[model samples]
Target: MFDPDEIRGMLISAAQQRMALTYSEVLHALGHRFTRPLMRQLCKVLDAIDEDGRAAGEPGLAVLVVRQSDGLPGQGWFVARSGSHADLPLDWEGTEARRYVEARQGEAFDYWATR
Candidate 1:
């Protein structure tokens, strides 16, 4: 019985710490079992957070979650602050996280410049 807010907090903490986490890692951290419905709910919550951040003009705080094709863990997520050059953890997988930030560079700049 994991709360969505708890998951959101975990993501924020991970971003602040400049780390990435897999779905399994998140589940283990919460002491929860793996279930498809829970996974779907997590994804939905992440999407809502992303939208909310964008609407608030603080879009860079959004975490990027990607489904991996490697089949080991199946999915992973990362939080990368805009303009940060901090190195991600060695265990962090996927180019999607980096791509996610790169994709939003212009929007982030625009938001900050207008603020």
Candidate 2:
């Protein structure tokens, strides 16, 4: 089974490195689908991470964990018809979206930290 925690960790690592990965990879890692609410929540998480100044290295993993609790898009991971830059096969998809999430992931803390 795909573990969200593990996926979050990878994103966090990518954030710390300030490197970006494919959005499809992120979805694959989480075993999720591309849905509207999921996309919104993911965006919200990124916004929250930035607002909280957790968009930097190493510490943003907490944000990922918290945001992850919002849940995956669906049962299986999402598929992108074209490149990662394509519409996410959903709307609101962007080239930087994946990187943005990664940056936030690195600053995440324990789930309790969010509460």
Number of backbone-clashing residue pairs for each candidate, in the order shown: 0, 15
For model 2, how big is the CA root-mean-square deviation?
11.8
- Candidate 1, which ten residues in sequence have the lowest lDDT sum? 71-80
Q: Which residue pairs clash in candidate 1?
A: none
Query: Relative to the true structure, how large is the alpha-carbon lDDT of every model?
Result: 0.52, 0.41
Error of 2 at 78 (Å): 24
Off-target runs (Cα >4 Å) in candidate 1 are 60-115
Q: What is the RMSD of candidate 1?
A: 9.3
Tens-digit lDDT string for candidate 1 (9-69): 7766665555556666676677866577777666666666766675765754334333334
For candidate 2, what is the lDDT?
Answer: 0.41
lDDT of 2 by residue, 7-86 (tens): 55565565555444544446555667755566545544544443344333224332332224232322112232124323
Q: In model 2, state the lDDT of residue 41.
A: 53
- The candidate scoring highest on TM-score is 1
90 Cα displacement, candidate 1 (Å): 27
